[model samples]
Target: MAFKVAIFDWDGTLVDSVEHIAESLHQAATELGFPALERNAYRNIIGLGMVEALDMLYPGLSREQMTSIREGYARYFFAKATMPQNVFAGMADVLADLRTGGRGCAVATGKSRRGLEKALLTSELGQHFDLTRCADETRSKPDPAMLAEIVAFYGIEPHEAVMIGDTVYDMDMAQRLGMPAIGVEWGVHDREALGQFSPRAVVGSVKDLRFALGI
Candidate 1:
């Protein structure tokens, strides 16, 4: 059966903002005098919430440190706003095709609600998705609640939906919810990392993703 709902992970899957996100975190850490992690280290946490990612990156933070870093990151993240134009080529078209095929489109992301809203506004891609779930609003990725919410919103079975993302958390989230997953390697994780969860397909490019989805 064809997928009825297409759930996407925002940073890597829809837009090429992985670097921007990582840099934002780096900028935050610098301002707060926190030591920076390697670039890939920051990228690896792309699909987790800010707090979770921060805790992982800077363990044993006081509430004040977490709040400071979060706000600092948000500032740089917005100030460095070229992301709307960074929407991956063919992604908008893919979304249009999916909607035309009577499929519901949604987002299951690790970004905050405000951050996602800002991205959606800047990118003007908000119209493409029928629904969106952010980490701040619910459980983060690898926990499955975000994907489950998208499926529940569309009233579709797990098999009737496909989660597309660039991270292991996305694949693991889908796996936990019994939903099929498609891994896009252009984001954070590579084929091998995303593959272990048994994604339906691990694609390297937007065109390949179209083919993978039978679009």
Candidate 2:
């Protein structure tokens, strides 16, 4: 195998939390007197951070309103939602295969630290990942800080690592850090959007991910 380390994105990439996210976004929007987004619109915002997603939803919202909406969203999310989300069909099997192959794996997500813990614990996917970097622990994506942190923590050179994600933020960060990225098609963004970051390749399914690793 050409890669020793693999890093994944949490939200739309590994887990299908779009329904929970939309429900929470709706609750927050209603509280803020803003219109709730349709499922598709909210899905488009899936890979972005909370602030960025809210900004897109209500562009004219004041900073204070944004803060309130975000807080409300988190409250609703934690109270009304339970995750492990919906594991992308073959994700668990693929992860297990990777682990068994002696590849080191981790996660970098915009999800809060606690949210990540809850999701991992619920999914029982924690055993597959060696480390997890969440928004609370590092700067949000598109910043490269999280990716850099993961690379450093794993003690691997950037080239020895591959980021697998479904968004431009993930791909762009990999690009910035001189690492390879494989974008997922069945995620928040489509191939065109992911292509903007020039990932090494675009994977249409979990089975393809094994090929991405030359398994």
Candidate 3:
């Protein structure tokens, strides 16, 4: 069946925020006197929720410490007012094409509700998505709850939706729901890593992604 909904992952998938995210994680760990993770280590956990990512980065932390780290990460990430998070090239056009094609567009991201909302406002891309589900509000990526909820909200079956993301977590989540998933190369994980989840297509550029989504 033709896809009726296109669900995207925010950070590395739609926007080029990997450096900011890695920096935030490093800064958060440093401020807390915790061992700072390497850039690649931070990148590995990009698709996880803040709480989950912190736990993986600094195990055996108390609840208070976790909260502090989360706050510190947010502070560092959003501190530079001039730093603009740019959407992937041609992605705006992809969203517009999807909209014009009568397909619903939405976000299923590991970011907190507040973070996602801030990004939408900052990027001025909120108008493109019909709905958004954040990790903090529901189960994070790798869990099917977020996708399941999105599909239900749109009154569509899982098969009618396609997940476009750059992580194995995103692909796995869609797989759990029996939904098709398309992987993007410009994100956290490489094509080989994402391929383990058996994505329908692993696109290397926004142009290929547009074709993959049939937009």
Q: What lDDT does each candidate get? A: 0.90, 0.83, 0.88
Q: Higher-lDDT candidate among 2 and 3?
A: 3
lDDT of 2 at 136: 67
- Ranking according to TM-score, highest score first: 1, 3, 2
Could you give candidate 2's per-residue lDDT for residues 58-166 as a string of tens digits? 7978889988988888888878444444787778888888898899999988888888888888787889998889876778777888888888998989999999998
Q: What clash count does candidate 2 reach?
A: 0
lDDT for position 89 in model 2: 78
In model 3, the worst 10-residue window by lDDT is 80-89
Residue 62 accuracy (lDDT) in model 2: 85
The weakest ten consecutive residues by lDDT in model 2 span: 80-89
Return whichever of 1 and 3 wins on lDDT.
1
Q: Any idea what lDDT model 3 has?
A: 0.88
> Which parts of model 3 have CA positions greater than 4 angstroms off?
81-85
Candidate 2 pairs with clashing backbones: none
In order of appearance, the predictions have TM-scores of: 0.97, 0.90, 0.96
Using lDDT as the measure, what is the rank order of every candidate, best first?
A: 1, 3, 2
Residue lDDT tens for model 3, 1-215:
27999999998998998888898889888977888667999998998888788778888899999888888888998885312348877887888889998999999999988888888888878899999999999987788999999999999999999999998899999999999999999999999999998889998988888777766
Q: Model 1 Cα displacement at 62 (Å)?
A: 0.7
User: What is the number of backbone collisions in each predicted candidate, taken in the order shown?
Assistant: 0, 0, 0
